[model samples]
Every structure is written in structure tokens, then in C-alpha cells.
Target: GIKGQSLPDHYEIDSSKAKKDLGITFIPLKKTMEDLIVQLADLQTMLEQS
Candidate 1:
């Protein structure tokens, strides 16, 4: 029971393997975060202009 320990090693998820094994294509975290930030900024700008 290791608490607060993320995967101890930097393991790159093999996309092909993921699709074959898990049937899911993982989205990179950085890209997801960037998209969220951009959406939030756009929403804030719209709110301010309204």
C-alpha cells in the first residue's frame, strides 16, 4: 500500500499497445491542460465584454 507514490518511473505509454490492450487512445496531459486554459480564457473574455 504505497500512498502518494505515482508510478515511480517515467513510463511512456505506447499508443499502439494502449489501443491494442486497453482499446483507448490516451490524450497527453499537457495538451488537455492547455486546451482547458484556452477555453477558460475565452470564457473570461466573453464575460468581461458582456
Candidate 2:
């Protein structure tokens, strides 16, 4: 999907059996964004240092 005025999109992801058997869980979006922000900030710092 594009940034703005995007068309509807979808993907095929099935871990249903795994979820049932292995009890896997998903991370929250807020935590994902926080981790991504930290990673990007670290990359930016490395670029500046270089």
C-alpha cells in the first residue's frame, strides 16, 4: 500500500495451527513503533558518527 489515498490491500498469512499448538502471540503496534523509532534513531546516530 502507498502512503496516501492507497488502494485496499491484503496478504495471506496463516499461523493458525501454530497459534493453536505453539501458543504464539503478536506484538502490539505501539510497541512495534517504539522499537522501530529506536532502531531508526540508532541508524541515524551511526550515520552521523560515520
Q: In each prediction, how many residue pairs overlap at the backbone (N, C-alpha, C within less than 3 A)?
A: 0, 0
The runs of at least 3 residues in candidate 1 whose Cα sits more than 4 Å from the true structure, single-residue gaps closed, are 1-18
lDDT of 2 by residue, 4-48 (tens): 876659868898988899999888999999999999999999999
After superposition of all CA atoms, the RMSD between model 2 and the true structure is 8.2
Candidate 1 lDDT tens digits, 1-50: 48886775666655797698889877899999999999999999999999
Each prediction's TM-score against the native? 0.55, 0.59
Q: Give me the displacement of residue 35 in model 1, in angstroms.
A: 0.2
User: Candidate 1 has which clashing residue pairs, if any?
Assistant: none
Q: Ten residues in a row with the worst lDDT in model 2?
A: 1-10
